[model samples]
Target: MGVSKMTGKFLKVKCGKCKNEQVIFEKPADDVKCLVCGEVLAKSMGGKARLKAKVLEVVR
Candidate 1:
């Protein structure tokens, strides 16, 4: 069996400015910003979040 679509996971990313790590929703309703540098990490496009930086991992 494969993973269900209903079970969504979070995305782990690193800030390009300060290298701070954070977890964000795969499909964020709003823009995801870095807590340290306040840089835009992801942008909501009415569906999945558009990543602005490199993704570290996916948190299941």
Candidate 2:
């Protein structure tokens, strides 16, 4: 099997409501709501940047 070139690290972001920390991976998304308090925690950026894939969403 070939190794996936698209890889990134999960980041720990603070929850806006509960102020709790959470971990997330590089995926396509708008913003992750806080699981604890239902408040928007952090947005998942397309940190898995790949030159091959154009569908990859870039957060910033």
Could you give candidate 1's per-residue lDDT for residues 27-50 as a string of tens digits? 888999999989999998878989
Task: Report lDDT (CA) for all predictions.
Answer: 0.88, 0.49
All candidates: TM-score? 0.84, 0.47
As for candidate 2, its clashing pairs are none
lDDT of predicted model 2: 0.49
TM-score, predicted candidate 2 vs. hidden true structure: 0.47
True-vs-predicted CA distance for residue 35, candidate 2, Å: 0.7
What's the true lDDT of residue 27 in model 1?
Answer: 86
Candidate with top TM-score is: 1
